[model samples]
Target: MAFWRSTSLFSSSTPSTTTINDNTINQETIERLCDRLQLATRIEDRRDALRDLKGYSKKCKLEVGTKSMILLADILQGDRTDLDLIQLALETLSNIMTYEVDNNDEQPNLPQDITIQFTELFIKNKEHVHAALDLIEETDFNIRRTSIKFLTILLTNCTKTLQDIILESGPMGVSKLVDLLQDEREVIRNDALLLLQILTRSNANIQKIVAFENGFERLFEILISEGGSDGGVIVEDCLSVLLNLLKNNPSNQSYFRESSFIRRLVDCFALNSIGEKHWLKQKETNINLFLQVIRILVSPTNSNQNIVACQRSISQCGKKKIES
Candidate 1:
């Protein structure tokens, strides 16, 4: 028996019932499967079907290639779909991309084609941004988290469209991205930070958005308030964003200098006597960032008192060069 026949069909116990084959999964069957996936009461069932479809893609089962890609793209384009399903679709697509990379396969790069289609869909569909925002607020933390990851991937791959979406979404979208900094999941937080970092780099207008929104303050708060957490991933991410923002807007160096952000970063170095685990590793990052911020502040062009304060803070923190 073929792989699709072995895995795609479900045998019914009733003698009158029949197993459905891959060939039978025509356009209508694809539509019905998509409908069931969208409306399924049980997450497990949806997940199982998602897994099967992803597996089918991996095995180069092109029988349902166009249909599966279209269905998955539809899910990606849906108005109020379950975030878990969205994430599953995204991950499945990502896995397909990875398989394509590893196997040097070119035929079933349907996901990439779908990505282009979804880029257009997201651009033309007014509901796209709202759906993404809703997914960010999903009750399931993992779903919420993965959606951000997918969004970042989408944004990275489809920069022009994502930038347009961000511009249209405006301060509200910026605020939503800021709120994710406090998310319990570090990956989501990091991705949000990264998006902000990317957006700030895209245009000087975004600098005004960041400054007007007190974005600098929020970044500092995350670094100072949460740096001591489990692995300091939050602190590292926050610091990276801060560094990028500062690099982009040299004027904002004053904000970091005045807001006690420098001191807090220095404190990370001072307090991180712990051995080299995740948190300590992150501590080293904070220290390096602290030094870089100091370097920026103390440049002859920026001879503010804040520069002196930063030097003093680093001195007090003790000299510890970040290992390359």
Candidate 2:
């Protein structure tokens, strides 16, 4: 969702305060956009309506809350091939349904209760969530990226409900998200990584599904490619997803150990050009997460064999570090 930045996706249709008098969106304008969306038969007209709706949504999200979700979902479900229309609709929905609500008494865009109600409506109707999920499969970059962003927001709103929906989407369900991890596009890969971290936390069934998709192999591969601790923020995100997959999930821990991915995990600690004194914030964070992953594998509660295997891996990593 990249904070629902309209400029990034639609530079031409960026929201302008001048379009809405006094930086306020009137109800009349809102209804007109809805009418254009419903009655317009031409593809261009519908696109224009959605674009305008997206602009208005940015102007005042509370005014657009829940009121336009049905129409937006309809566009998502009814028109899959129209990339422009879908991207606009998704961006509009993202703006309208953000966790960032303004509680200011003078100009409250969305109240807490309204936010809950909006989330509940989307959750109660599984179709809306599924529609967004299907869009992730689209080849169009903006459509796929926007849909992923929208789902991230939804998941953040109500984790349990969203997690259940994604899990019920069958084996291919989690696979779609997992596939994004390998996408050549770094931003898309990073977005997918963040979503996976949230989605897999404390959810053993989903974790198993992810692991089956060769999750550990792909993630570690990315870690090594990114230069491990020396890599940018993407490295930390990758580690976070790995942590979520293994944390408190004994089945996943055993699977990780059995898969013989420990060697790959140790490789992350290999020394890089940046020494400890020159380690930046992200590098420090990444090293801490790597340490956390090591701690999890070697914890006492784990079977002695697993702990010993992890210890051996650590000793090997240390020896490599010393010999270098």
Candidate 3:
């Protein structure tokens, strides 16, 4: 949050441009971390370097983080077989990506050379970046979890530069994240759902990914999944994502219908509607989210059968809620 740049960096005509000046405090920390990381011959040494690298990333802030990140990227680009090292590197990347989006320390009137080149290197070269992207598929839960967490943070907080870089990276980046819904871990699946929600909320060139052949099916699986207990994270996140995907997107709406998501929804509601009227009381928030999804799916042009099915679900919900 401290400012080291001079007053002249702020030109009246250039309000949008900001730059990261080379400061001794930030630069020194970055240099030390880089040296430790490069000279890491022992497992403990690498771990310490990764640990300090993460700390320096934060301490250096925007521009300093950029320089530290360039070195960080170089370390990761090497063939890193050590799982802990990989996790640490991925986490550091996540922190760096996050720093790119923080505006609190931004000096808007300055030149933006360091930050610009910093971002350009990561985006322009796809091969160097794939090492982090490949970690999403690791069977190791911790690595996969870190990768997923990193990705969701990137998509949610980063500006268009990162988004464009991701989308432009083609199937390796965004597509890989989308494919995690089928992951065995419920936590990972929900994390993927969170990512989809961000993409939906942002509407950043996500039409193709949403309309993928199995995308609807995967989301539908989450909708009816009984994986989690009454917290209803699966149901809550799926509805948010489905609503976002279907809103103002007629093609996806049609796809939703074609994919039998409505039928599955009705079945899920009915499945949850049995025995006592008190059953629905515990899942009030979930039912509301489900109902909201139904609201989004219903259109004036829908066929009568679809309407009847929807109404049946709504009526079933209502009946289930009434005290017997």
Candidate 4:
């Protein structure tokens, strides 16, 4: 099946074309469109220009085509202004983002504005956020993984917006994002971890959002689960985020400390004895992460018995390493 079809970007039936008379277009109009397309800076202006460019493309006007080509060349130049142009370009490109153009297809040369537009939209909009999420659900695992990576870049640029969208999507989006921690794509997993990191920055209400959906247990399972070789980087990131959340919520800390979750986290670094040999190659990284967890667990600000238990776990792990 076609990728776009899976994403539902196009209709099942072929779209009918409405022809425009080329002779009605002139040089001046093309130059004006070019100028409007070039001057687009903010989200609104870029969106307008993209709509106009689509119309121009549909009209088959040579002058409009020339203007679009010039704009696309300027965009692909990798100018410092590329970020500003991403949203506009993305909106226009959404017209084509999921489609595979033929080798000899007469594809319009997208401007810097258009390229930036897509990048920006990917960074800003909640709808685009959902699209990125759905991409993770694709039948092709690579596409699912790539979607997460793309989301990471977007989250880096639009932290507030990313948080807002995640919050708005509520438990469902949170669950999907957490599930991605076990995905085959390392980058996607890393992005999901980063996203959780950002979300934890919100007040207790947002941190509580995780518990509303049983996210804590799901996260623990990922850390302790066996099939996470591709997710080591992400696992480390997830641990960092989890530590932050646990530190912030006294109730959560007390609950996990009593339930064996804390011990299980330390056991995650327990050499080949943990039952997963594939993790050996990543032992050093995992050990460093283990140390970080122990430091957080033993911090003076934490409760007494929990700190002692964490210290014991750390010492045991070190002794086991020495014995080996």
The root-mean-square deviation over C-alpha atoms between each candidate and the true structure, in angstroms, is 9.4, 7.2, 7.1, 14.2
Q: Provide backbone clash counts, one per model.
A: 0, 1, 0, 17
> Against the hidden reference, what TM-scores do the models get?
0.61, 0.85, 0.69, 0.49
Candidate lDDT values, in order: 0.59, 0.79, 0.63, 0.55
Off by over 4 Å in 1: 1-51, 57-87, 93-130, 185-187, 194-202, 207-214, 221-234, 271-285, 299-324
- Candidate 3: lDDT over CA atoms? 0.63
Predicted candidate 3 versus true structure: per-residue lDDT over 268-300, tens digit per residue: 664444454574444676667766767866656
Q: Using lDDT as the measure, name the better of candidate 2 and candidate 4.
A: 2
Better candidate by TM-score, 1 or 3? 3
Better of 1 and 4 by TM-score: 1
Q: List the residue pairs that clash in candidate 2.
A: 1-149
Output the lDDT of residue 90, model 3: 72
* Local accuracy of candidate 4 as per-residue lDDT tens digits, 1-324: 111212222122343442123233434555666677778567566546656665544333233433464354344233324343443343333332222245333233333243233445344445656655555565464455445555555555555667677668766776676676666665666666776776666446556666545656767776766333234555666676776667657666656665666556655654445565554555556566666666666788877876787677656756766777
Best by lDDT: 2
Q: What TM-score should be assigned to candidate 3?
A: 0.69
Backbone clashes counted, model 2 = 1
Q: Which stretches of model 3 miss by more than 4 angstroms? A: 1-29, 39-44, 59-64, 97-130, 171-173, 202-205, 227-231, 270-282, 299-324
Q: For residues 125-147, could you state the per-residue lDDT of candidate 1 as single tens digits?
A: 54555556656777677767766
Which candidate comes out best when scored by TM-score? 2
